[model samples]
Target: MDYRKIREAIIEETSRTHVHLVEVLGDTITTRLLKDFPEVSQVKLRISKPAAFSDCDAVGIEFLVHR
Candidate 1:
């Protein structure tokens, strides 16, 4: 697999996305990865929002996609 292409895909998706929810972002990224990299069988994604709460480090969402 071309790691550079994969990285560029992720960057492009993230940079162009305007979604507010982490779950939606995760889904978007996962979908883009699967579409861009057919050889990939699975995608495990984690998205975080730092300092979402005063007492905790961050809030985030994680999900896995299989092809």
Candidate 2:
């Protein structure tokens, strides 16, 4: 996603283009949240910033499986 400007300009030039790190953190947090609260089965996360007219930082991801 670092060089995602080749296709979608909006995704590369938006104030909320943090799906990368957002989802990663989402998965992590989701795992923890699930552990603490088993009632919730779904989690969605989003992170955004202001950088280069769009704003974004490196993103990492992780997911957890509940059994």
Candidate 3:
């Protein structure tokens, strides 16, 4: 599949799951992507949202997955 298709699939699946946690979302994506692309042995995902405080731009979480 192409990059566009892979991206669309990820977005669709993530929305369907209705999961809010960054860690869970990263893990879920890693698992699903790895199934289709065995050459990918690692996935590094980062999620950021508007900062709760006025000090910075955003707050985020990063998850690294290895198979």
Highest lDDT against the true fold, candidate: 1
* Candidate 2 pairs with clashing backbones: 51-55
Off by over 4 Å in 1: none
lDDT of 3 by residue, 1-67 (tens): 4777668768976888677676677777778877877777877778776864599998788878788
User: How would the candidate models be sorted by TM-score, starting from the highest?
Assistant: 1, 3, 2
lDDT of each: 0.89, 0.45, 0.76
Q: Over the stretch 37-66, how does candidate 2's per-residue lDDT look in tens digits?
A: 556565443444335343465333445455
RMSD of each: 1.0, 12.2, 2.2
TM-score of each: 0.91, 0.36, 0.70
Q: State the weakest 10-residue window (summed lDDT) of model 2.
A: 1-10
Can you give the lDDT of residue 39 in candidate 2? Answer: 60
Instruction: Estimate the overall C-alpha local distance difference test score of candidate 3.
Output: 0.76
Quote the positional error of residue 20 for candidate 1 in Å. 0.7
Candidate 1, residue 66: lDDT: 93
Off by over 4 Å in 3: 52-55
lDDT of 1 by residue, 1-67 (tens): 9999989988988889587788877888899999989999999988899999999999988898899
Question: Among these predicted structures, which one has the highest TM-score?
Answer: 1
Would you list the clashing residue pairs of candidate 1? none
Task: Output the lDDT of residue 62, model 3.
Answer: 85
